[model samples]
Target: MSEQITKVNSWVLGLTGGIGCGKTAVSNMFEELGITIVDADIIAREVVLPNSKGLKAITAHFGEDILLPDGALNRAELRAKIFTNNNDKEWLNALLHPLIRIKILNDLNNATSPYVVLVAPLLFENNLDKYCDHTLLIDVPTSVQIARTVKRDNTSSEQVKSIIASQMSRADKQQKADDILNNDRSLNLVHIELVDLHKKYLQYALHNKTNSH
Candidate 1:
C-alpha cells in the first residue's frame, strides 16, 4: 500500500542509516537548518502507547504478558518473543508498520519547513524510501557500527552484530541511496557536507513547490 495516498505539498527527504550510524546526528543537523524531521521510531512508540488501538491489538494477540505492570509495552519481553519466532516478528510488523506510516505521512504533510526529513532506520527495508523525493544514507563501516552501538547502548558486540545482520547490507543501502554521507570522519567534516546537502534540498523543495503549482 502507498503510504502517501494524498498529495504531499512538502518535499520529503528520506534519511536512513544502520544502527549507530549517526542518523540522529544527521537529522539534528537538518533541524538546525530549520527543517522538520518526521521520525518513524518516535511514531512507532506513540502508536503503541497505553490504551491505544495498536497496544490493544497487540495485547489481544500476545496477551497481557506483552505489557508491563505500569501498562507500557514490555519491549524486552516482546523483543525476545519476536527474536525466537519468525511468525511473531512478521505479525508484529504487520500490525505496527501501517500505523507508523500513517502518522509519519501526517507529520510530513503538516510540515511548514522547506523540506521534511523522514528519518527511518528501516527506510529501504520497508520500502518507505519509495515515497521520498530523495534518499540519503549515512554510511559507516560495520566495525564502527558495532563499536558505536555497543558503547552507546551498553550492549554486547555480539548483540550489535546480530542486529546489524538483520538489517539490509551496507553495500545494498549504498547502492540504493540517491545521496550518501560517509560519516566515518569527524562531525566537523560531516557538518560541512551536510551544509551543502541542506542547500541542495532547499533547491529541490523549491523546485517541487513550483511544480506543484
Candidate 2:
C-alpha cells in the first residue's frame, strides 16, 4: 500500500498467501529465525480498536450495525457485508487501507532485525508488494486451501469458497512473487525450506547494507 518508506534501513520481504494457506504458521517459522515480522492482520485489528479513528470512520460509513455491544467492530457481520457487495468492500478499503499503510510503514522503519517480514494476506491485492524488496508467496493448491480453511475457521464450504474467490488467484500471485515456498507438505519440510530462505535473506540484507554506503 505504501510506495515509499519514510525511513527503511533494512530489506523487507513481503510474505503473503491466500486464506487457509498456512500464512500464520509460515510467519511463525520466519519469527523463529529471529526475523522481525510486521503482521497486517494484527495491525488491521489495532486500527479498528474501540475508540480509534479507523473505527469511527467505519461506523460513519457502514453505520452502527457494523459494531457490537462492546463497541468493537463486528468483524463477521462486516466481512459478510463486504463480500456480498462490491461497493461496501471498496468503501471499507478506502477507509482502512491508508491507516493500515501508515502503521505498517512505521513498523517497518522501526524494525531492528537484519531484515523485516511484512506478513499480509492481501499483500498483492493491496499493492503492499511495492514496499518490499522481495515478495514471497506461500503456495498451496486451491483444494488444499479450501480444506484447511474450512477446518480452521469452521465456516461453511460455500463461505470459504466465496472468500477464496474474492482473493487474487494462486496462479497470479505465483507469477507476481519474487520467490515462493510450496506449503502443501509437512511443517518439518516447510521449516527446512524456510531455514534456507532465512540464510538467503540474511545475505540479501548484508548485501544491501554494504551497497547503501
Candidate 3:
C-alpha cells in the first residue's frame, strides 16, 4: 500500500491527567471497548529509539551521558535533569515535540479502528488539544496522586510531588475535559464507568455520523 493510502479510520480521543491520576489505566479500559489507543509516551520513546532523528537531536543537545552504552537514550537521567531545569525542559520539548507529533499522526492514520485514544499526560499543556476530537480527564485527589505514583514508580513522595508540580492543576484540567472520570473508587466501579462512557461515546459518534449524512 502507498504510504498515503493506509486505511486507518481512527477518531482521536485525547486523554489527560495530573501526575499519578491513572490516565493510562483509564485509557486501557477504553481500549478494552475496541478503540485504537495511540499513546504519546510510547510514540515519544519510539521516536527516540537508537537511530531515530529525535535521538540524534537529543544527543546533540544533552550530550552522550543521556545515552546508554549501547546508545539508547537514558530516560531516567534525562527526565531528572529536564524536570529540575525549565530551560532544559523547553529545549528538549523544542527538539522532540514536532517529531513526536508526526509519529503520532502516522500511527493514528494507520490504525484500523473507527476511533483512536491519544493518551498524553500533558495533553493540554503541550497544546495537543488540536489533534483530538474530545478530551477525557481522570480525576483524583492530589493526595491519591502522590500515593499512587510513589508506590507505582518506586520513587520518593518528594519526587512524585515535583512531577505533579510540573503539571497543570487538576481543576484546570477538569475544566477543559469533555469527559470526566473519577477513579477515586474501586476497580470494578472504574470499569463500570468505562463501559458506560464507551456506550455514550459510540452514540455520540453515531449521532455525528447520522447528522453529517
Candidate 4:
C-alpha cells in the first residue's frame, strides 16, 4: 500500500500537527499558492458518508444506534463508544484505516499541483509519512494547544487534554519532522514564514522532478 502511494508522480509533502495547532490555516496558505492538499480528515468523513461501504460495515458492527435519524453516521455516538472501549476502537481502526488510506492514495495520485500537501493528523502514527518526500510539522505549546482546542471545539479542558494525550507527543513529532513551523504567535508572522517555506518547497519539488527524469 505504502509502495503504491510513494510511487505516484508527484512530490508529496506530509503535513501534520496536534489537535489545535493551526493545520487548517497553514494548509489554506498552501492552497492559495496552488498546492493541492489531500486531507485525510476530509477523506475520513467521505468514507463514512451515508450508503458508503464503510458506513455499512460500521452499522453492522455497532447497530442502528450509531446512526442519525437521516441515516448518517452519528459521529459523536461512535466517538463515545470507542473512547471507553479499547476493543471497539481497535476494531473501528482496523475497519476504516485501510479504506481511508486507499482513498487518500487515489486522491494523491490524481493531484496536479507542483507538490502535493498530504495533511493528516495521524501522519506519523499511521506511517503515512513514509511516502512523503519531506515531512513538515506545525508546532505549538501543549498549553496553547489545549486552550485553542477548548475555545474552538467548545469542549472542556479535560476533554481537550485527553485528546492531546491520545496523540503523538509534541517532542516526538518535532524529532521526526524534516521541517517545523512554530505557530504560537501572530498570523502575520506565520504567513511570512510560510511564504519562505513555500519557495523552499517549490525548489525541493523541482529538484525531485529533475532527479526522477
Candidate-wise lDDT, in order: 0.93, 0.91, 0.83, 0.93
Q: What TM-score, over all chains together, does every model reach?
A: 0.94, 0.90, 0.86, 0.94
Residue pairs clashing, model 1: none
- Which 10 residues in a row give candidate 3 its minimum summed lDDT? 1-10
Candidate 3, 40-80: lDDT as tens digits: 88988898999898899889888899999998889999989
TM-score of 3: 0.86
By lDDT, the better pick of 2 and 3 is: 2
Cα lDDT over the full model 4: 0.93
Compute the lDDT of residue 40 as modeled in candidate 2: 95
Q: For residues 39-125, what per-residue lDDT tens digits would candidate 2 score against the true structure?
A: 999999999999999999889988999999999999999999997999989988888888888889999988998999999999999
* Model 2 weakest 10-residue run by lDDT: 1-10
lDDT of 1 by residue, 137-198 (tens): 99999999999999999999999999999999999999999999999999999999999999
Q: What is the lDDT, from 0 to 100, of the residue 147 in candidate 3? A: 95
Clashes of each: 0, 1, 1, 0
List residue ranges in candidate 2 displaced over 4 A.
1-7, 62-65, 80-88
Candidate order (TM-score) = 1, 4, 2, 3
